[model samples]
Target: MPGFSPLELEALALSLRVALWSVLFSLPVGLFIAWLLARHEFFGKGALNAVVHLPLVLPPVVVGYLLLVLLGREGPLGQALYRLFGVSLPFTWQGAALAAAVMAFPLMVRAMRLSLENVDRRLEAAARTLGARPFDVFVTVTLPLTAPGILVGALLGFARSLGEFGATITFAANIPGETRTLPLALFSMTQTPGGETQALRLAALSVLLSLAALAVSEYTARRLRARIDG
Candidate 1:
């Protein structure tokens, strides 16, 4: 904290804020999509799967650009929301969180999907055989089994969101104390003549934070495996 300047602190705070919101917003939707991919068969299911995983295949900049096209002030949804609620996202922190969420979604969905795939179908069947509704079966049996994976997915999403740059910058222009998250701040440092020192500091922080997230994820995954095994 002592070595971190005000700008670095601001960027770190913004990154955490954006990552948290992105993960929180993405969690339920990601779980539903993951469940669909892991369990159900339906028309266009393959297409839906592809679309859900598209962000992983596409360039972050392209994703960000598409978001800008669809959510910018002049865009249809953007215009409607602006007129109806007086809310705007472009070039704002919310926009940054949106960009982060979009970029991180594929990772979250994949993790949860894998978890759901590993769920014991027999357990769900037992729940249903006992006259439990499909919804109740899922809530009581599937979700509890999948909770660990959901947590890992959320952590993965948070880490991805924290590092998100191209999409965020493309959709929400970097402004210090606002859209300038850690990655953006580091990138900005590179462009500035005397900001190398600051860049190094931010880079170190980024590495540490990423490592911490990964450590927690790995530990949690181990616990999940142990529980299943026991």
Candidate 2:
């Protein structure tokens, strides 16, 4: 507690906010992509799957830089966004969230896709036979069956976002009260004399948070499976 300053707490809070928002923003997209990969056959399907997983293979810094180039103020998409909505991403916490989201997207998609694949197509057919529309079948059957996977993906994404360093720093910079997440704060502390204590504290906090997320994810998945079996 001695090492936990108000500033440090703020950084922790911001990191949590970014992680939460990133997972929220990416979850729906991940679900859609997962459903497509699990159930559909189309031209370029392989390519799209590869593209969805690209972030997992690419360098985090490279992903961050690409985001900057595409979503920065003068970049084409950035410019269009600014012209239309006056919203910007670079140098802000939201930008850091976006970077985290993009980097964690592959993991989210993979987990969801696996979950979707586990869903029984026969169950979906039964729903259709029972007069359920396509949308109704998906909403009531496919989604519930895949809930465990979605929860796992979201938790994984949150953990990944918390530890994100290169991508977040590159896109948002390590400014206090803005974009300085736990990792960034820890790194910053290492550079200053007598900052080791605070760094250690932040590191411990990061570990605890990650472990908590994993535990929750596992518990949730097991409970879901039990209910389904029941």
Return the top candidate by TM-score: 2
Candidate 2, 127: how far from true, in Å? 1.4
lDDT per residue as tens, model 2, 18-123: 9999999999998899889988999999999999988899899998998999999989999999999999989999999999999889999999999999889999
lDDT of 2 at 139: 95
What TM-score would you give candidate 2 relative to the actual structure?
0.96
- Stretches of model 1 off by over 4 angstroms after superposition: none
- 8-121: candidate 1 lDDT, tens digit per residue: 789988999999999999999999999888989999999998898899889999999998888889998899989999988989999999999999999999999998999889
lDDT of each: 0.91, 0.91
Scored against the true structure, residue 168 in model 1 reaches a CA lDDT of 94
